[model samples]
Target: VTLPPKIVPRINICSWTYSPPHTHTHTNPLFPSDATLEMSNLYAEQKGKTLNLTEDELLTFYGILLISGYNSVPRRRLLWSDDYDVSNTAVKDAMRRNRFDEIMSSVHLVDNMKMTADPFFKVRPLFKHMDDINKTIPIAEHVAAWCKQFIRGKPIRFGYKIWSLASSSGFVHQMEPYVGSHTHLVETGLGQGPSVILGLAEKAEVPPSAFKFYHGNLFTTLSLVDEMTLRGDGSCGTMRQTQLHNVPFTAPKTFKKTPRGDAEYLVEVEKLIVRWTDNSVVTVVSNMEREFTETEAKRWNKQKRTMDKVRQPKCIQDYNTHMGGVDLHDQFVSRNRVNIRSKKWWWPCFNWALNSKDLLSFQRLVAQTLLLRHGTKPSRQGRRSSMAVAITDATRFDSFNHWPCNTGSRYKRCKNCGGRTSFACGKCDVPLHVECFKKDHTE
Candidate 1:
């Protein structure tokens, strides 16, 4: 098939310039508040009511959220507990527990009326309004798409299963939630895996011919390499032996019987396939590199009980180096992830994006600056927090404080049954009936 003509000029890969959409005019920290306002407004619109949430309240909400990552608790309300060990003075002072709950429950990025029936509908709106503002490689040659599943043995074993596209340095360029066969763009012959990579690459706006994509067996296939090569891009990834339709590679079972350092390769229509044995066996495919050069790598020798240096294919070495971008990004995101529990599935994805690098200082600086400029403090001030004494059964059933005495002429309503009574508890000093004297304290 004839390849499409290129419109973008291909310059020296090492010398290409990157220009950001916006340049910094000043070091003012309050600039980040624009995002906060936009998010808060979006949420209010989604709420379908007058939220009346001020900038301070919203910042305080974020401040409390950032603080949660540092101070985790079994129950979210425990953050407002009277117990000094469980409670945070700053969090309690910044906002009330109910207010925090209200914001957390109502916060959203898109209006429900416009939401599509897609699997990613919950968090798609957040991605829709987001802009790429991070410093990325001028020419991102090492791009990868990997599945972050919610299965057991994974760090995040019970969250959204997402497909991510990332750069070599672990900067996530784009993400799409896995939605079965319909999740990615449909390529009639490429199937779901390669289609996912294509969809993410298209969405990420990666420049043609400037990237070398990497993935694992799940996305790699003989046809995928040819398809990518046709678009002036390169492909390198681990491949299943079965995916090689016409290539004559030794069966994995037969290859396992060979020596540990045994290797094989085949060149078909400019595509290269390398199968090597180290621990077990590995097969790699690439349209970008050949098996002309090999590198040495250390492997544990079970029989000899020593480390042995084995010859490794260059394509294999490159795959090992560049395929970890998605994994690295996952590690960074989960390190200080917001732990606020919400029933809304979208909250997790939304919260992941909202997490800032400088957790404490970002919100504090923005909130304080806005407050100072407006000459107003947070709506809720720090009050003397008192523990709500629990009326335990032990205290109620105590036999000693049972004395009841007659009050003056006027009778007051019983604390328990709401009946007027002239009698009162001598110790508790609350009006109670003689009949309820025992049940009032005990039951």
Candidate 2:
């Protein structure tokens, strides 16, 4: 594939020249809000600069550019490279269209709990517009066609964090056939904190009931399986790790005997296919920097040790096993600190206390950010976010609080109570009450 010439040149220019001030006036609006994002670039400062990206020696720069996007502290900041840069021309376009600034400003406003439009701006139009409906159905059919046409009929995996990635649902819905129609659907990339483990437990890509959640901190999920087997036999005797219902845990039926027959690894196999990993194992957050503040970071590391300690017993009692110290990746590695006090190896910073309450609270924070990026909602002070999508007062959406609490969020409408909620079962923390949950469904 041919590379974009400006991609290399533009990135290098920005990394070297752009060092944003640590504390800028938040109200100054560094970039304007009234620009169109799709048609603009944010850079014009490097007009005369010449950067060659078509050289063989420069090919390595593309890999670097891509990895930098992954390794950067926040993962959002762009990096410089010898080649394959996004030009200042692009930045200028972004600013002129007010796209980048608007997106960022929208994220910022939502994090602060500001309203952005009625929250369901697109959703309302989505339901009403036949053209929009026409656009939605074919993507999934195309995905299935592409897979069958190219891959010679193999199972496929589809994924999205239903709660946090509500915007992605359209694409997923379009691609729904590839997921629901007998493909090896795999999904992951849950949040990085305690939610990481809970995400695993919820089994977003997989069914929550299919697997058990163990408090035991195995060297990895593989090690956990090794311990779960019957004495010298290959039987998967029943024992619960992370519990949902009274489901029996079974060993790999056809899968556990392959060369690297680790059933624990099955969940990621779907990811390998979707991301073009070609059925090979690849690492995402492999070499982490573990950076954090001195005083607070230490406290977090210590608490993790305590949680690790607590989890160790459950792991051992259930599966006649033992392990060394807990691993950060197993639980969480602080940016760069050690948790010396966590009775469990996996105590997280925020939701380590209560999964029920804290999970919703943190997710709410994330949802607010999403609202600002995609809506016409104004903040409390009426300082409109740049990414705000304008909808008339006649148009309204479910509040940010009404977002689905989990990946399988179903909009529900209450019958008797005339309320709208997201949970079909009237489950608490589903982002709406039973009345609203059911009402939304009926309406």
Candidate 3:
């Protein structure tokens, strides 16, 4: 996570300027007054009746959603279950189960009266709102694809293919869901890859020249690098060998025979292509300078039976340093996402929009603030782990009868810290370490 040489770290923290009533300041940004009013109006239009959703009800619903990220149940109704051990009193007190179900069913973002044949029409408004928010914060951009891929061992195996632009701080600037080849893409003419990069660059609203963009091989073409140079932006990325147009670096056969850390580079006017060998051949293309101060990277050596240092080029170092913004953003969103299931195609993306910040302290603060305003009590445990994770209901936390017992032969991952354990709650049937049993259930 080192920033590139040209980039200077700027820290600007907002103060908690809220007066006595702090509710509006915390919740309003995520769900604005106009947005909420529009949602209620849309609900009535869809359901053929008035769904008078007040500010309190909306905040409570969001609070419940936040809580569910940690305390998940197989069914939503289980939150209000009749069984004392499994039931949640705060949830039951905040809203009726049927009312929750009603809101879920009628949560419309756009009017159905203006329906189109497009699959994305339902959730289009949400993306628009997100993009509008991004415009308010001026920053350079990077790109990534959020999609369901059949790629082996990929974590996100089933999701929509969303092309997104994110800043160096992991803030998403804009997003467009990819449909297919017929879907509109910028005509960079180099291919779909360059087109996506250019499209995202254009959408970011900043002068293209202001960006020092970094991308992976998927979007890096020789022409794309040249195109970025023409647009006055510096660029660097790993390149597919095929996109190289047969640039004569040491021939692939000869390059394989060279010693580890050996590098062959071609310097054209204002562009650089480098092939460096470590465990595998790394081909990097950059519009930056040909020569840069070289650094060393530790690599495992099978022959020496130890880690050895390999020479690393500046372009490769810069790419590594700045290329993880989208990935970091993905990591933040994936963690602590609400465990809400839906048949709608847009549910995951909608949930993603809400869970933008995966900071547990913020989530816990927001959850407690909103829920407590409606009479839900905070956790009695004062010195719990900062992580907002729990498997059991908060209402059941005070039931002093719980204990851990061995599972005899089976070992399962601990619910508290993900360590392997054979011991588990005697009643709940969840695995946990002996020391974590109390904290896990109570927190």
Candidate 4:
């Protein structure tokens, strides 16, 4: 198949007397040398002046320009040389470095101080909409009042707190005021240190027992021994050292042979460590006391011609089950996300909260539907009687002098009932029995 010609820019190098073309062009297409020169020339042509850029700066600038022009296109379809890939990586690295600088400048680095206590550092706006909903008080005061009311009401239904906690990024201080003194179960992703977890629990007026944190491997490593050492087999070199320094007490080793004829090991260090057969370790930090529990799984055994047993820690099972509630809520929120882009740092967060409210509203509606479906049935007559009652409740009647009925019957039947008609509704223009007319119109 004949491939289309590559789209190369037509540059007028005649105007450039200082730099020679040999200094820019390269033999290899992958490491094209002229990328910087081409960008510099283009910049000069556009602004009608030369840019005094260093070699590194020129490469950086060229990358940004390249991305700005074609980043929207798919990577495979981008008809550019391999140099574009190198430039893209450089641009991303530069951005990451600059982001770190920006964060350091914006945030204060403090050891023991509570950043949430800063009154001016608001994580969320006081009121998203103020003009129509709340006009009597200042936005701040209105927000305060609303928080108190929300706390008292406790808007979320049961079994949905995990969804709420995860979707909010586990920032308890923002929700603490609104949640009041009620203890709540909070779930958080990795990077939450001991200080952060305890601080959030304190602000939320809940004990550490209420928090279930998923500590990241990096953060866990800082506090605990290497995961390899904690494996059940005691094969890793550091097992003896880990037992002496890290664990308080190690459980008796349990073994179960898998269907694949491989032995699986399981061990627990009371409440602290749980090492499963998969060589994964979990470090639980909580104030609540939990007894070690195990669950049995059935596995096929070819030699025995029967199902073999596989043991799993209850902690690991629970973690696996409940950890993704926030993720599910996030997926729901992302479906109708607002696509507005802005330079303001907080705009992304603001957009997220706005989109999240829609999810919460939907959850409430679903809860209501479930309640209505399963809740107590009201004491009433038959279905027809109930329909009559509903229709009567919705409508009212007025008297009229004469009403025409299109019914061809010599003796008209009641519109509401099968009984012979004696009266007619003036407004509805329907003939009705005296009793049916009174039932339909009497309020």
Please name the candidate that would achieve the greatest lDDT relative to the true structure: 3
- List, residue by residue over 196-301, the lDDT tens digit for candidate 2: 2333222223222223222221112322233222112111112213321222222223222322211121112111100001012111110011111111001112
The order of the candidates by TM-score, greatest first, is: 3, 1, 4, 2
lDDT of candidate 4 over 1-443, digit per residue (tens): 22222211100000000000111110101112243344434444455554443334333322332233223333321212123332333233333333222222232112113345432223222221211122221111000000112123456432211112221121112232222222232433322322333333233332222123432221233232222122211111012212333344223232122122222122333222433433322233211123445576566667799987766545444444333433443565556554334464544443444343324344334333333342332233123334444544454443434344344444776777877765676666578765676675654
Report the poorest 10 consecutive residues by lDDT, candidate 3.
10-19
lDDT against the true structure, per candidate, is 0.63, 0.22, 0.66, 0.32
The candidate, 1 or 4, that scores higher on lDDT is: 1
Compose the digit string of candidate 1's lDDT tens values, residues 162-222.
7777665555556667777546454646876678777777766766674677778877777
Please estimate how well model 4 matches the true structure, expressed as its whole-model Cα lDDT.
0.32
Evaluated against the true structure, the overall lDDT of model 1 is 0.63
User: In model 2, how large is the Cα lDDT of residue 351?
Assistant: 17
- Candidate 2's displacement at residue 174, Å, is 9.3
- Winner by TM-score between candidate 4 and candidate 2: 4
Candidate 1 clashes between residue pairs 3 or more apart in a chain or in different chains = 141-212, 396-441
TM agreement with the true structure for every prediction: 0.70, 0.17, 0.71, 0.30
Candidate scoring better on TM-score of 3 and 4: 3
Better of 1 and 2 by lDDT: 1
